[model samples]
Target: MTNFDRITVDPTVMSGQPCIRGMRLTVRRVLEALATYSDRNELAQEYPELEDQDIKQALEYAAASLDDRVLELN
Candidate 1:
């Protein structure tokens, strides 16, 4: 998925932090929840807006972003 499509930047939302599908849910929040929670079912239960695919997609998005990064020193 394109970063522009899956992730959005809107000043009104979370101070323009990158979010999933322009929703109020930020990627950082999602990742944190995933890291702390062991049960996907429990997570889905707590976050009605999220599904298994959403969680998976968020993880994939994070991974892709990390993989594409190149540190440059000038």
Candidate 2:
């Protein structure tokens, strides 16, 4: 699935931050959980509403965003 397919952005939700399937959870939140918890099963347990793919797709979206970037020196 594409990045936008699993992730959503709405002005009414989280101030338009990227969310999971229009839910209140943000990609940053999930990534933070992954960084701290460091266990997929534990994260799944913490946020029972999300599946493995949701977290996976969040990561995919972040990675894809970096893939399209260019850094410049002034």
Candidate 3:
């Protein structure tokens, strides 16, 4: 899914931070979990509602966002 489809910014959630599937979980939290964890199965176990694909999507979204750059015109 595209970042816009999977990630959402709502004033009621996490101060409008980009979140996954409109849930309270932020993209940063998902990325952090992936970074600190080795076993995908274990991670899934800890977050029963989230699957491996969710983590993958979060990474993809983060990567795509990193590619975005703001250019300054003089």
Q: In TM-score terms, which candidate is top?
A: 2
- Can you write out model 3's per-residue Cα lDDT over 1-74, one digit (the tens) per residue? 36456778899999999888888889999888878778888778877777656677788888887857899999
lDDT of 2: 0.87
Q: Rank the candidates by lDDT, best first.
A: 2, 3, 1
For residue 27, model 2's alpha carbon misses the true position, in angstroms, by: 0.6
* Deviation (Å) of 44 in candidate 1: 0.8
- At residue 28, candidate 2 shows an lDDT of 94
TM per prediction: 0.71, 0.81, 0.76
How far in Å is the alpha carbon of 38 misplaced in model 1?
0.8
lDDT of 2 by residue, 1-74 (tens): 47368899999999999999999999999889889887778877899998878988998988877756578989
Per-candidate clash tally? 0, 0, 0
TM-score of 3: 0.76
Global fold similarity of model 2 (TM-score): 0.81
List the candidates ranked by TM-score, beginning with the highest.
2, 3, 1
